[model samples]
Target: MAELLEQRSSISLQLIDALLEVFGEFNQLNIWSKVTKDDFTVKRFDLGNDSNLCCCQLTETAKSKLNFSSPKDCEGVVVKFLTFGDNGITDNGLSLADIVAVNTVLSINQISPKLLFANSKCYVHEYIKSRIYTFENDDNPEVVKCLARILAKFHSLDAPISNNAYKTSQKSYEDFFNRRKHIYGWGNTEATGQKYLKALENHPEIKEQYYDEFAKIDYHSEIVYVQNLKERLDSPIVFAHSDFNRGNRLVVKDSKDQLEKIYLIDFDATSMNNRGVDFGDYFSNYRHREDFANEGFPSDEDMALFLNEYREKCAQIFGTEFLDKKENSLEHMIDEAKIYTLGSYIGGTFFGLMWYQEAHDTGKGQYFLNVAKNQSRGYNRLKKRFIEDGTIPRILQMPK
Candidate 1:
């Protein structure tokens, strides 16, 4: 037992060494105050088992050893350990993508977490003592408008990233669709499909009634059609936060300024995409992880409130000259946003499915399963409305 424990400890030390190797040595970070990795210890934060990265909060051991006067003096840090695949290559440059995104967002004076140090393997950030806003709990009218303005400013950024990796909605959807081909009933060959089936095996009704029916729709053609409509409608492409879900929207507890309270985090999915997708995706988040049968999409008044704030903010950023154009008009963008809402529904469906698959894989309890199902059902409801009401086709045929 002693020998086995020693081996485990040696492996952990080796892993930590490898993590720090990306930056050469701990002292090189410049934030260390002349200390090294051995000077302090970190406690792993329990974010979830499903994350691709691990987070560790710097503990009081460091503060005491460093003899900091107060918590605010040092402020501490959260170190994020990024994972590499078995082949010893990073996950498609996730760490670098986030670094590039952070640089761009900070350049725009956007409210993202301050990244202290980052490389391809790992990064450190000033720990935020903040709360997350969920639609079910913090869905205040004013909060919604604030989020809209934040999003508007976010989408207005035009900055260069690591490799100019910008892609259109059609292009992004094609890649995503190809990856989750099991959703289109090609699960026999797709690993994700096999796991999806295994996860939902106990709930055959969801498969027969919802999943099967959803698979019947040709999402590829549908996405292509939407892209064409988007072009005719003149929907402007912008740097999108892409995943504007509740968790990424942090409400800093210390900030009394309402304008400064909210911060956007997690820029892994940040990219150039249709502005409508960002708007539509934010609107669709109202029903995320709620009681699917009871909760509904944001009311028309609420949506109008959000959209009006967004429009006014965009006008401020782009000037009335640009917004006055046919494609940039409020009415046209609203119509375009409606078209993209369908795409958001598709995104929500897969997001829920992926979560559910992960939940099953990790042997998570029923509560987690229900949470995953709520997401799928809620977005499915939105997709069903568009289909039954012929909303997408109507939007497409409308005057551009």
Candidate 2:
């Protein structure tokens, strides 16, 4: 046992060393040494236990290797190092890297040059602009144009084959959503409602009201609704950034209030899926349903202008039929978006419930559970809107 532990320790050190070698040195010393140079300052942080995976930032000296001039308002390049445990999923880093690469390509092609670097232990990405938080508030046309262009670019990337080293095939949208359901052991409306009920039982004050609303749902009625809708969706699969929220996107504006550039970050949840899935994430993450309903979701005028611009750009880059199916494309897209929205809610709730349970054991679960409950309420509200707006019934009409 002693010898085995020693071997493991040695391997860990070697991994760290390998990472440093790829990232290069910080000043004259190694990354760890440099960070700990001032003992008193470093003592306050528990860097070693900051994350489940081994992670650290690259020093400015190390970032100098990229040969970029530091902007007056810019922070230095930050490289995050992470390693999976023996039982943990290994493809996470690679998937994230893929998203970064794809997004970088799109941004550079349509906007300006941005760079992404990665090695086995870490991924490094740099953006010239500030991150954009809410798309609704961002009025920069260039930013909007760049976003649409990147989405088109992302859709054009080659789908992962089963034999690829990165296991892109495993990153398919269907696989991801299905795996999510399996992991949570909940399916359909009834199971989902029961799960919410259980979550409420654990946190009555935060979840009771929401649970009551969910409990009133008619699960059997939604069966035909879901089954019929499944048959109508025959859209071709494409590469999608499964988590294309505004948080993952960055934007830069000119003095005239025109968007100069936009950058997409955090590709950890990217995968091949329907375009509607990407749009759903975009809408939910950036523009909450309440905001959309009150203000009118993206406005028909904006959607029309954005779609026209997106289709034109995509046709130039890929082909004329890049967003084909002229007759019912917009409606189909909207329906798909609704599906993804509900799907996100269901998936998020399950994970939140699990985190709450785990947090309870560690005495830190209430906050996370509260977040889940709130999100569940939001999703339920959105679902109700979809039903009232005839969106749910339309999806229900889809073929299984």
Candidate 3:
């Protein structure tokens, strides 16, 4: 472990040295050191007192330890190094347009980390103002509602010049299906046709078979009048945080226990998509984290509370009349959320099981195998709940 940490530190130093070439005039203008010698210092940021996310801090002057006692400890320009092997870094850093949009949101109520510098290797941002407790992965209801309200405010903001909507997540979902299918040895061996294959030897109702009905659901183009007044809508797709996991939702509060600011970090997955994408993420993915002992998948009543809180927040920003459209789209949004939640759970479970059995990474085999079973149980339970509560329509009854 020490050797691994040493190697990581060595690599980050190399990256910072290389990044200096990109910083050029800004390094001096920003008072950031270009050399990794005595002047420049790099240390792994102990985010939330845990290292699940590898974050490193680079300082201009020699500062070995960053004081985290208070928000004031985080000062001036902060350069953070985020490396995701090879696929993440590109020849061009964060596009100027993306940075502008990120900043616009932050300007409102600290919806995200302010993007200060960007290059092919990583992003640099103003150090977020918050104490360690504020940034912890907490499951407090107030924190959850605060996060939801912040997201509402983000979506309500006037679009930035470079912030027009675009769609890539659906394609990525298809890619995940392909990768999980291939890893499980259940889909076509071809490079591009994996997504179309059907069924697993053990799980016949998985993949294509289970997803076909939901796949037919098209919110925008194919609109069917299921009921008057509450017709399913293709709600205006907006900028979405593709990965709004627990780790990314950081919060800041005042001495009065009032929520001050909640900072959304890690824009690596930022994209333009239907808001349902974010809803689905919070509902199924983030809620399952170990921190959220409140509820695994928040109960319908709890989810309703979240929606109500979000609607109230939206009403404040976009006006009471604005909520009518959201209300109309509520059913469809929940539908989208369900489809995504189901697919994600099943896909993740299958991947774990396949890795344990086929890939022979047996070191964590039992744990993953049990995780697969637990996920399956959770999925089945949620499926039953949805069917019973009529949160979603009967499987074969919906339009094919």
lDDT of each: 0.57, 0.50, 0.50
Stretches > 4 Å off in candidate 2: 1-19, 25-75, 84-113, 127-129, 135-142, 159-231, 254-258, 289-302, 322-328, 361-366
lDDT of 3 at 177: 48
lDDT tens digits, residue span 47-146, model 1: 4342333333334665566555653443455556666657443333333554555554653474676666665666665556666766643456677778
Clashes of each: 0, 7, 1
Instruction: Write down the TM-score for model 1.
Output: 0.73
How many residue pairs clash in model 1? 0
The better-scoring model by TM-score among 1 and 3 is 1
Instruction: Tell me how far the alpha carbon of residue 226 in candidate 2 is from the true structure, in angstroms, after superposition.
Output: 5.7
TM-scores, each model vs. reference: 0.73, 0.65, 0.66
- What would the per-residue lDDT of candidate 3 be over residues 111-204, giving only the tens digit for each residue? 7665556554445666554643222333567776777787787666655533222433444434544565566333443423433222222344
Residue 11 C-alpha lDDT in model 2: 35
- Rate residue 370 of model 1 by lDDT: 52
Instruction: Tell me the tens digit of each residue's lDDT in model 2 across 1-400.
Output: 0001122223354555554464454333322323321110100111222332222333465445433234421232334455654643345434344544554554455432243455545654332435354645445555566677777777777744222323443343345445644654334456443453565566667465455654554333433343344346644466666667655566666788656666565545455555665766665554453321222245435555455566667788876665676522666665665666565554555555556645654655665565556656656676788889887776666555
Off by over 4 Å in 3: 1-13, 22-29, 33-36, 45-109, 129-139, 158-166, 179-184, 187-236, 254-258, 285-295, 326-339, 350-359, 362-371, 394-400
Better of 2 and 3 by TM-score: 3
